[model samples]
Target: MSETITVSGVVATPPELRRSSAGVPITSFRLAAGQRRYDRATNTWVDNGTNWYRVSAFRALAQNGIASLRKGDRVLVSGKLKVRDWDNGVKSGTDVDIEADAMGHDLRWGTSRFARPEAPASPRSNVEDAWAPEDDAAGGEVTDAAPEAAGPSADPGRDAWAVPGDPILADGEPASSPEEPTQADVPF
Candidate 1:
């Protein structure tokens, strides 16, 4: 079972926004959370090692992250905790990763104003509408700029993620409008 965890940390790097091969939005960054201990002899807080984690967010959260977060900012992140084992020729170790469900600036250090992202014109459109691409100044219209594919092997050939009105099968007919989900759609 995956465990949910929350950690407040300083942003160690700039947020990088990229798209998966299936056209899903994603963002990732390094977070550094430190610890301090009071020393009786010195009567001062002693430095303790800092724990580092890589945090990743998907879809709307990913978009919001690009707009809201920056390097060195104190932020709160809560999500599923994943511990991964890794090995190189010389050594092996575990790395911590958080698949963030929610993230925002920590208000304790400073104040922030909340602004709701603009609503999409229609529900039928995808969330990509929330982050529109910039238009070229030369007046040439460019549509369907493919998003960055997910991994090293991701390529145009593998991009078959379905969008609204896309054909569900290879029969070449457009799909009908999506309907509300029912109990069967729930994996649980």
Candidate 2:
């Protein structure tokens, strides 16, 4: 039986990334969660013990993990835990593995940056504004020579994240800046 678990620990080994014959990606790494205890006798903290886990991430998580994780970096992983007994001619033991569903750096120890991928193109042919007038009556040819005439939206291709009050918000990208994606934008 497998149960969901969340664990935070240091990466014990550098993540190994591999792809299956079918081209699916997978990244695996070892995690070490150490225990600390306060020693009243010595007036200091002491190392208690450590627990290790085998973590495996698939798909985009695997790609990200390979790019981001390094040995000794602190991270939090949430996944389904599976304990399996394995026997070798020399020895036999139980291995604890976590098939990671979500994982990220532990910000308590350090900081991390996030970069979101651009949305994939949809089937519907539409980049122009839906409500924009079909016909341009006001001499509507945007030229590089006269960017000011087009108002604050000088470049209409890349300003979805423009600030609400910024001059660039005149009439180009969406009014509201979305951090990630919305269900409506996805064509499925």
Candidate 3:
């Protein structure tokens, strides 16, 4: 039986999206999770060795992973975990891969905005088709164009939460342009 596991780590490589011969969309990435600790002998913070994992996502998760995550971003991934042994012509080693069910940016690292995709009209339509990229040419390799940024607004002053500059009201509207919301304006 596959074990479900959750892990948080920094993205070590850009997510690469590809399609299987059967046309299933898949995305994979390398993650580096370092263990940090205070060394009593050193009297300072130190990083224990880092563990690496290969993360794999299928279907819509594959598409979203490419669009939402990048190298150096901190993310939390939860899914079925598998370990496999591999041997090249020269050497061999065991590798760990997680078939992700859910993945997202770790909020402890920073904030994130969410936008849901529109539902398909017909259930019969293939979801993978929507996630798959068009081929540049028949039998040619797929282009690796970077997906547009969807993390934060271009304007630094805008956040939906109750920040000093942009304060969202009870009704979910921004404060008036005349003035920023004062301490009294927020309900608490």
Candidate No. with top TM-score: 3
Error of 1 at 99 (Å): 0.3
Question: In model 3, where do residues sit more than 4 Å from their true spots?
Answer: 121-169, 172-188
TM-score of each: 0.64, 0.64, 0.65
Error (Å) of candidate 3 at residue 44 is 1.3
Candidate 3: the clashing residue pairs are none
Evaluate model 3: give its TM-score. Answer: 0.65
**Alpha-carbon local distance difference test for all models:** 0.78, 0.78, 0.76
lDDT of 1: 0.78
Worst 10 residues of 1 by lDDT: 165-174
lDDT of 1 by residue, 30-106 (tens): 99999889999999999798999999999889998999999999999999999989999799998999999999999
The true-structure Cα RMSD of candidate 2 reads: 12.9
Q: lDDT by residue for model 2 over 1-188, one digit each (tens)? A: 69999999999998999999999899999999999999999999999999999999997789888988999999999999999999998999989999999999998998776654333354554443222322333434322233344457656444233333444443564457658878997897
Q: What count of clashes does model 3 give?
A: 0
TM-score of 1: 0.64
**Model 3: residue 37 alpha-carbon error in angstroms:** 1.3
Better of 1 and 2 by TM-score: 2
